[model samples]
Target: MSLFQVQGLVKRFGGLLATDHVDLSVAHGEIHALIGPNGAGKTTLVHQISGLLAPDAGRVLLDGDDITALPMHRRVAKGLSRCFQVTRIFPAQTVRDNLLLAVQAHSGSSFRFLQPRSQAHGLYEAADRLAERVGLQGCMDGIAGALPHGAQRTLDVALALACAPKLLLLDEPMAGMGPEESQQMVQLIDSLRQDMAVLLIEHDMEAVFRLADRISVLVYGRVLTAGTPHEIRSNAEVQAVYLGTETLEATP
Candidate 1:
């Protein structure tokens, strides 16, 4: 069974049908990419999946449990975690401090003055591992906000990883990144497939083609098609509506 499933999801904003019976799924350890033009309801679908907005209808299932009605935090606790389009990190704190906070939250250990020394050591160790995992080990002492845009995004991803999620939801992780940074993010995301499934919503078609095990195209709040990279590239309809004449090669 798929690790995550969105079954016939429907959402509305007054007179507007923001999400229209959208059905999507991510299998265990698969990289599933969602793509579309602006106003395609991709963000609206993501919002409902992440519990930022409850769906007007349909069910969201994570590892066989129904989670459509669960709040964001509850979903996170249930092994579903999200990294927003905007980097969500503690800018004023050092990288280590930021990771420590995330690790503390999910590790069930507090950083209290009276907390056990061994537990505190474990938290610090976990924080260091996270920084290394995201290639931020060298910047542990640096203020998060002072880091480059790509590094901040990497940190945001690491925060989500702290939850040890069964499924990871990444929203435009490569947005605003230069070629080198985008490549780096792609590699990072690729590596994550061994540990968890990813539901990626991105505008970067090149990255989508590279990283996605399967791609689902969304249009006007509904799924237009889902297929492998080659099939998506070959589909005349997808080419017309989204890719146009733009080459689907990694930016160099």
Candidate 2:
């Protein structure tokens, strides 16, 4: 059975059909990539799956449990987490402080009797692990906003990891990244499938083809087709509508 399922999801905004009976699934440890042209409703579909917006019809299920009506935080509590397109971090704070806050938020206990959070051994250790996990161990004391763009994005991913989710929703993680940064993120995302299934939305075709176990194409809020990378790369319909003729002309 699939670890996460979006069944017949539909959403509407007045006359615009933003999402149209979309069905998608990610199996255990699978990296499923969602791709589409601009205004194709990829963002709308992601919002519904991440609980930022509710679907007008159909269900969002995690491990076969209906989460369609759940709020965002509740969905996170139930092992679904999301990283936004823009990196979200505490700008002025040290990376360590930012991580501590995220760890504390999900740790389920307030500080006791004006006690310093730094005195909490477990939080510090957990925060350290998160830093190492995202390759931020050396920058723990550095200001979050001062980090390079790719590092900031990596830190954002670390924040989502604090939730220990079963399925992670990554929205355009490679956006704004140059080739090197994009490659680093591609490596990081590729490693994550060992621990959790990932629903990735990205426009970087090379990275998508390199990492995705399966790819889904969307157009005007509806899924056009889904298949392996080779199938997508070779499909004449996808080539004409989304990938473009020249984009894959050089590819075998």
Candidate 3:
């Protein structure tokens, strides 16, 4: 069964329909990718899914619970986490401090009664674990803004993971990375499917083909096709659309 579902999702900006009755589903342990050309409204669809924007008409269900109308924070609490195109971190804070803040924000209330010093240990342990999960342990003491671009992006994913989400939304995770960094990100994102389903909106065809279990091609605010990587790669209509642009010939 699908763990996340978006039904008849519609979003409008003036007379232009940014998202047109779009429907998408992601199963547990699946990496579903959303891809399209510029101006295809991919980002708008993501905004609605992540609760960053309210849809004109649609319902978002996570684990069978409706979250379409909830605000961003409420949706996050409901196991919807997003990693944005830009790195969202405290520039002056160390990696450990940044992870600690995120962990504390999503943590339960059990530490309320504990002594201050004892609480510190628990937070530190959680922070360390998060860092290690994304291979940021070596740079735990590095300044957040000072980390290399790839590491900053890795840290961004770590921050999203801090929420313990069931469905993780990755928005152009490899947007500004070099070839090497992109490769590392692909591997990191690949690892995430072992834990939770991912709804990835990315422009990098290579990464999408490499990591996606299911791929949905969007055009003009609508899903043109949805299928496995091999199916999408071999679709004639898809090729026709991208014929003037780059070919989707990358191997996973």
Candidate 4:
């Protein structure tokens, strides 16, 4: 069975059907890319999967168990996590503190105001390990808000990993980055697939093609196609909707 599965998922906002019976599956340890133009329901679908928004109809299964009714925190406890397109971090906190808090949250510790810092040594050590994995060790003491934009983005991803999730959803991880930063983000993501299953929503075609083991194309709230890079490159419908005819023809 697939590690993660969404079957006939539907979500509506009043009269607008934001997601139209979408079905998708991610196998164990695969990097699956979901690509589409703006307003294609990628983020909406992700929100449903992450439990920020519940689906109107259909079921979500993780490891053959139905999780459609689970709340957000419950879902996280089940080993699912996501990183948003916009960085979400405690801007006023130091990098170490931010990650330490994440570790504490994942470890189910109390959120006490007067808790001593020493009480979180194990959490900090785990946070330090994650920071090192994402190449953020050098900025451990700096205020999270003061770090460079690229580093902040990396921190966002590191925070998501604190839960040691089985399925990781990344929404446009390279969204506002320059070429160099994009490259770095790609490397970081590539390094992660050895241990986790990833569902990536991204606009950078080059990165998508490079990192994805399988690709799903969404258009107007429906899947247009799902295939390997070579098959998707030559698919007539995909070429017509997104990749221009000229570009399709140029592919050998």
Residue 227: error of model 4 in Å? Answer: 0.9
> For model 3, which pairs clash?
none
Per-residue lDDT of 29 in model 3: 95
Model 2, poorest ten-residue lDDT window?
109-118
- How good is model 4 by TM-score? 0.94
Clashing pairs in 2: none
Candidate 3: stretches off by over 4 Å: 108-117, 243-246
Quality of model 2 by C-alpha lDDT: 0.93
**What digit string (tens of lDDT, one per residue) describes model 1 on residues 1-252?**
999999999999999998899999999999999999999999999999999999999999999999988999999999999999989999999999899899999987755847665748888899999989989999999999999999999999999999999999999999999989999999999999999999999988889888999999999999999998888887889888887756543331
Q: Which lDDT tens digits does candidate 3 get at residues 1-252? A: 689998999999999999999999999999999988889989999999999999999899999999998999999999999998788999799998788889888886343425585757878899899998898999998999999899999999999999999999999999989999999999999999889999998888888888999999889999999999888988889887742225566656
What residue pairs clash in candidate 4, if any at all? none
Worst 10 residues of 4 by lDDT: 243-252
TM values, all candidates: 0.96, 0.96, 0.95, 0.94
- Which stretches of candidate 4 lie above 4 Å from their native place? 112-118, 245-252
lDDT of 2 by residue, 51-162 (tens): 9998999999999899999999999999999999989999899999889889988897574536765678898899999999878999999999999999999999999999
Q: Write the per-residue lDDT of candidate 4 for residues 47-101, one digit (tens) a residue.
A: 9999999999989998888999999889999999999989999999999989888
User: What is the lDDT of every predicted structure here?
Assistant: 0.92, 0.93, 0.89, 0.89
CA-only RMSD, every prediction: 1.7, 1.6, 2.2, 2.1
lDDT of 3 at 171: 93
